[model samples]
Structure formats: C-alpha cells, structure tokens
Target: MMTTYLERASHALALVCRVVAGIALVALLAVTIADVSTRYLYRLTEGAIALRVTGSVELVSYLMLCSLLAAMAANVEKSQVVVEAFSHGLAPAIKNRLHGVYLLGFAALGLVLFLGLVDSAQSAAGHGEVTQDLRLPMSPIYYAAAALSLLLGVRSLIEALLGALFGRDAEVSHGE
Candidate 1:
C-alpha cells in the first residue's frame, strides 16, 4: 500500500528527534568526560592547567533536558509500555480500539503539556531567565521542548485516527 503524507511526515519527525537526541547524548557524554578530565588535571597539576569548565554543571543539565525531550516523540511512537494482563483476553478489535482511545488520551495530555510549555517559554523570555553560570537564555530550550511535545501530540492523534479507521492493522509499527 502507498504511504500517506502524514505518515511520511511523522517518520521524518521521528527520525529528526531521534537524531537530535543521539547527538545531545553524545555531547553530554563528551562534556562530562571533559569536565572530569579537567578536574583531574587541575588536582594533579596544582592549578597549573586551571582549565575548569565554568558552566559545565548548567551545560550538562540543559543537554540532559534536551536529550530527554528530543527522545519523547520517538519513545511515544515506538516504545509505549503495554500491560498484557489487561489486554490479553480481549479480541484484537477491542484491544485495538482500546489502544486508540489510549493514544487519543495521550495526545490530549501532550497538547496540554505543549501549551503549558509555550506559556512557560513566553514567561521565561519576558523575564529574561538565564542560567546563572553561562547566562544562557532558557526560553529556547523551553520552545524546543514545546515543539517536541506538539510533535508527539500530532503523531499520537494521527495514530489514534488510523487505529480508529483501520483497526489493529492500522497501528503504527516500529518498522516505519
């Protein structure tokens, strides 16, 4: 069967999110290693190197948050936890409809989170919120998080609709 534009878009979005999340994780790892190495060098050289990363803590924290939010969409799409005890006895059609309802509910929750994040981003921007160490603006991170939430929301909605229309077969697969 031919793929829909929405499916293509969802796939693209998931790919992008996963890629970003991977990059963020790598960056976090690299930063942590660098920070630890610097600290060790400082201790060994008795302040000769003196090359402490001034904002390493704040930078790592931001990277962690970014990695988490960036992975959210792909996780929601592909790795949702299932309770087989609750679904094992149901007919496939019933199970699928239940899944659809669950997806829709998730989508609604995502939408609420997205809106709240947007508001928080705006407030942070207005207040000129910044990291104490780096003085990095917080609004951009919030905005990125809001965008990821929106992406998850839309992807969930689309999956829900497909499930409603096509039953079990319409459910999104990890292969996509």
Candidate 2:
C-alpha cells in the first residue's frame, strides 16, 4: 500500500516515542533498584549508613507517567482491547466504520488531554510550582506530557482519516 506523508510522519513519531518510553522505563527501573537497595542497607546497618535515594517516589512517579504517556502515540490503535463477540454479526464495512468512529473518539480524548496538560503547564509556570520531594519544575514535565498527548491526537486523527477514506475492512489486524 502506498503510505501517505501523514502516515510516514506518524511512524517516525512513533519511533521517537518508543525510544523515549524505553529510556523512561530503564530510568524507572534504575531508580527503583537504587532506592530499594539503599533502604535495605540502611535498615541492615541500623542507622550506620544514613544513605537512601531522596525523593525516589517523586522520580518514579514522573518516570512512570512519562513512560505511559510516551507509549500512547504508538499503541493507540494497535493495543486496544477489542471485543468482537458483540460486533461479530456486523458486516466488515460496518465494523470498519464503527472502528473509525472509535478512533475518532480516541483522537478527541487525546486532544482534550493535550489541552489540559498545556493549561496545567501554563499555570505551573506562572506559579513556579515544582514537584513534591524533588523540587523539579513541574511546567517542563507538563509540557513534555502535552507534546506526547498532541502526538497521540495527531496519530489517531491520521489513522481515523485513512481508515475512513480507504474503507479498511479487510486490513484490520489487531497485531503489532
């Protein structure tokens, strides 16, 4: 199939999101390991070793959010929990149309999330709010989340448009 420019762009963005998500997961794992190890050692030493990862909770929370948000752009269509038993009787074209409508709703949801993140980022910037425990600026994190949300919206919108225009009935594969 001849892919459109929008599809190409979305694919590239998915690649980027995948890389970032992987990084976030790795970072999260490292932080968790370090925190657990230090806490264990501190307990064993009976206050002799007063060393523990400060704000590990904050770090994990941020990384977890980033990883999940980063993954949405790539997996929105591919990772849906499809229940075909109810729609099994529908014609293929109708199924395709219904799926397109579902995708449209998902796109709208992503757009709304994007807007909310941007607004929160603006408010955080104005108030100079930082995260609890770790004093990391919240605005930047919100902006990053906003970008991911926008990417998800665009990817979903493009997929919906393509599916509707091409009438993808036979090409629906719920596989990565």
Candidate 3:
C-alpha cells in the first residue's frame, strides 16, 4: 500500500515537471527565433534599425539548463541504459531487486548533483555573482536547479525502496 501511494505521488510530480520542461523548451525555441530574426532584420535594413536581442545567449543557456534539470527527475527511471543480457535469465524477484539497486544508484547521483548545485549557489550568492551577459542573479537559478536535483534524489530513493519492498508495481525493463 505504501509503495503504491509513493508510486502514484511520484508519478504525478514527474508529470508536472515534464510539463515545465516542455514549456522551457518552447521558450528556448521562441527566444532563439526572435534573436535570429532580429539579427537578420538588422542586416536586411543595412543597419538602419539597430535592433538586437541582448542577453540572448545567456537566456538560451539558462533556459536549456532549466529544461534539462526539470526533466531529470521525470525521465530518470525509463531513461536508464542498462544491459539486460545477463538479467534476462534471472528470476522475476531477482530482477526486481536489481532494478531497485539501479534506482538507488540514480538516487545517489541526484544527491551528488543536489549537493554540488547547492554549494555553487551558496558561493555565488555570497560573491554577488551574476550572468556575464544578462547580469541576472545566478543564485536563484542554482537554487532552482538544486531543488529539482533534490526532487530527483528523493523520488528515486522512494522508488528504490518501493521496488525493493514490494515488487508488484515496480517493473524494470531495459531496452524493451
């Protein structure tokens, strides 16, 4: 029952994050288009209109970063690349445990990322750091990334524990 609940709750969270990631990607596309079009328009006008999207590069980088970070937790499980050749012959119960171990590994990775992002954000905050082009504060971006990393770690950990404790809802398939 506990595993079931965890699975459902985590699934919902992943769905929401997936939407956020999608929106970020769309925004990235729009920004790129605007930047390029403005550049082209300026050239077409022979410098008549001094129009350019400033900080576009920085904005792209930030959007890409946020999109990827938002996606990590949502896609971690199904995106794992594992060789299933040996596990093909293993019993169902053993396979489940192996999957649990894999999930735990993901949790550990997320924890590492969370620690690093948080540390960097703190350092940036202390130093009053900002992006080179946009002059936007860096700490908030780092904090948001750190929060997402934390979600990845916690959700992965919960799924790991769920897979280990109960095998009914925990299914693992690699390259299938």
Global lDDT of each candidate: 0.77, 0.80, 0.80
Q: Which has the greatest TM-score?
A: 3
Output the worst ten-in-a-row residue range by lDDT, candidate 1: 165-174
Q: Which portions of model 3 show Cα errors greater than 4 Å?
A: 168-176
Arrange candidates by TM-score, descending.
Answer: 3, 2, 1
lDDT of 1 by residue, 75-130 (tens): 66554456999988978777666766778876997799899999999999999998
The residue-level lDDT of candidate 1 at 85 comes to 92
Cα displacement (Å) at residue 114, model 3:
1.2
Clashing pairs in 2: none
Tens-digit lDDT string for candidate 2 (49-93): 978899999999989988998898777666445578978787766
Candidates, ranked, lDDT? 3, 2, 1
Taking all chains together, each candidate's TM-score versus the true structure is 0.86, 0.87, 0.89
Report lDDT (Cα) of residue 89, candidate 3.
Answer: 81
Residue 11 lDDT in model 2?
68
**Candidate 1 positional error at 58, Å:** 1.2
TM-score, structure 2 vs. true: 0.87
Show the lowest summed lDDT stretch of 10 residues, model 3: 167-176
